[model samples]
Target: MSGEDFEDALKYTLQRKGWKLSTTKKTGDFGADLIGHDPKGRKVVIQAKRWNSKVGVDGVNQVIAAKAYYRADHAMLVTNQYLTNAAFELAKRTGVEVWSRKRLNAEIEANIPSKSNK
Candidate 1:
């Protein structure tokens, strides 16, 4: 999917799972693609990426700033592609949740039943 499509799809997927989320403006979003509250009502900021290549430290870095800019309690970088080792390390160290393809799919499946299941 294209980058914009991926962001919208991710937002829809999360909403299907009952998360209250809002998409940020395309410009001047301050690095946040989506903003919302988690289950415990803590604010969250997310940066969504759809890339063929492994996501790098830039993605993690963006979310780091997004959390601070949004004054969020948590930050997440969700992507259809996995992260680079360096990005992974940075995310772990900086408390940015990196939701790689596997994690993203898991969250999708949590609420979206497959057609095969019927």
Candidate 2:
């Protein structure tokens, strides 16, 4: 998926999971694609990356900066691909959640609405 498409998909997914979501401006986003409050009202800042290659530390740094800038309680970096080792290390140190394809899929599966509920 393209970057824009990934952003949209993430927005929809978060909304389905009961987040009040909003997208940042395209030109001057400063690394944040989506910002919102989760179901329990914790603030969240997210950076969405859809790339063929592994993501780098730069993206992790951006999300960390954005979390501070937005005064969010949680920060997440969601990517269609996996992160580089450097990025993973940085995220671990910074308490930023990194959601690669596997994690994302697991989250979706866990949160899927039951047939009876739907």
Candidate 3:
């Protein structure tokens, strides 16, 4: 998927997960593609990347900066690719959540209601 399409999917997924999401402008987003709050009202900033290679520290840093800029309580980097070891370490130290492709897919699956329970 394209970067824009990935971002849109993330926004919809977040909404399904009970977040009030808002997409940022195409340019000058300062690393944030979407910003919003959780059900508990804790602010969140998200940076979405659709890359084939491993995502690096630069992406993590951008999300961290965006969190600070938006005064968000939580920051997340959502990518369709895996994160580098260095990027993961940086995110752990900075309290930023890095959602790799696997993790994101799991989250999406978990949010889906089972028809058996319906």
RMSD of each: 1.9, 1.8, 1.9
| Prediction 3 TM-score vs. true | 0.91
Best by TM-score: 3
The 0-to-1 C-alpha lDDT of every candidate, in the order given, reads 0.90, 0.91, 0.92
Clashes of each: 0, 0, 0
Q: Residue-wise lDDT of candidate 1 within 1-118, one digit each (tens)?
A: 7788888888888877677899999999888999998777879999998888999998898889999998999999999989999999999999898889999988877878678989
lDDT of 3 by residue, 1-118 (tens): 7889999888888898789999999999988999999889999999999998999999999999999999999999999889999999999999998899899999878877789989
How do the candidates rank by lDDT, highest first?
3, 2, 1
Candidate 3: minimum summed lDDT over ten consecutive residues — where? 105-114
Worst 10 residues of 2 by lDDT: 104-113
Which model is ahead, 1 or 2, in terms of TM-score? 1
Question: Between 1 and 3, whose TM-score is larger?
Answer: 3
Model 2 / residue 113 / CA error / Å? 6.3
lDDT winner, 1 or 3: 3
lDDT of 2 by residue, 1-118 (tens): 6788889888888898889999999878877999989999999999999898999999999999999889999999998889999999999999999999899888777777889997
Poorly placed runs, candidate 3 (over 4 Å): 112-118
* Residue pairs of candidate 3 with colliding backbone atoms: none
